[model samples]
Target: MRAGPLCLLLAVMSMATGAHAEESSPLSLSAGPQIIDLQQRLKESEHQRDELSKQLQNADADRESAQLSRLRQENQRLKLQLKEAQATAPQRLLTDQQQWFVTGGGVAMVALLCGIFASGWRRQRRQWLN
Candidate 1:
């Protein structure tokens, strides 16, 4: 009868200890759907960050291209202004060699014209004058 009482007391103590152990057990924690939802939200946030980074990069490239175009236009306008300024300045017209060529061609043209007037077609006119 004493052995039976001792056995019953030991079994009750074991059951109480087991209940407390389960309450503090890490594996007994229950958040099955909550864990899956957290993971999915994290992935979506990462994808959004990646898309924002790409959009920022594209905007910077477009801004740089626009600035470069403006600089090119300004450079063209400056070149035109420089050309106009040069046109207003006094300038040496021609080199000595160019002047010689121009003068020589004019004399040649005059000689050719005189030769045409004094050629065989006008010999009779010269004889009649003589």
Candidate 2:
């Protein structure tokens, strides 16, 4: 009884495999032209992609070069301005406002010192009974 079922299973498996093989052979015969066409399309698309990438790189390089030239010009102009500034006469160390502020501070310090010194106890002022 076991052998009978085993034989039936084997027979069904063989028929299924044979049917799959027959179907795949016809498909493979017709797929030759389709595969070649797909490969050619892939190559064309790859070529287009390469060209587009090169164009993008060239555009970037052009923009970068233009910016570099502008920066160089600006640097040169700034250098000239710096040289002109350095060639001019030396300026005073302090501006008018700063000088005035320093003078005021000195006067305040002198006033404070004088006040402390003048307020010292004198002989007459030391007599608390007077």
Candidate 3:
């Protein structure tokens, strides 16, 4: 019975040692076109990235041009509206805005002249004119 158990233990230890050796071994390299294939994949990825970058740049340029054109159109539309408003507004509005200060000055001068005339008449009455 002891011999049988010892033999079983030896077999188990041998299997464990073999498993550890396999775990520590390095993987063997392929000698075919694997390296060339990897390089081709890398180049393809680079080319794809370059193409995508160019496409993005083109999209951005198109977007910018569209924005510029839209702004220019809006500016033209606003100018048209301004011209139409000028044509439709009361013509007197411009005259009034431009000459309000002159109108106010004329009224002030008339009021001053009236006050002077009234005061002169009152003073002459007090002086007893023959």
TM-score of each: 0.44, 0.58, 0.50
Q: What is the per-residue lDDT of model 1 for residues 1-130, given as tens digits with 9 covering 90 to 100?
A: 5999999999999999999998997753468778889999999999999999999999999999999999999999999999999999889698889999999999999999888877845544335545
Best by TM-score: 2
lDDT of 3: 0.90
Error of 1 at 22 (Å): 12
Residue-wise lDDT of candidate 3 within 1-130, one digit each (tens)? 5999999999999999999999998655873478789999999999999999999999999999999999999999999999999999867744666598888889999999999988875654356569
lDDT score, candidate 2, position 48: 100
Candidate 2 structure, TM-score to reference: 0.58
Clashing pairs in 3: none
| Alpha carbon deviation, residue 35, candidate 1 (Å) | 2.2
lDDT for model 1, please. 0.91
Q: Please list the Cα RMSD from the true structure of every candidate, rounded to 1 decimal place.
A: 19.2, 5.7, 11.2
Question: In model 1, which range of ten residues has the least summed lDDT?
Answer: 120-129
lDDT of each: 0.91, 0.92, 0.90
Judging by lDDT against the true structure, name the best candidate: 2
Counting clashing residue pairs in each candidate, in order, gives: 0, 0, 0
Candidate 1 residue spans exceeding 4 A from truth: 1-28, 90-130
lDDT of 2 by residue, 1-130 (tens): 5999999999999999999998887556778899999999999999999999999999999999999999999999999999999889587899999999999999999999898789874545355665
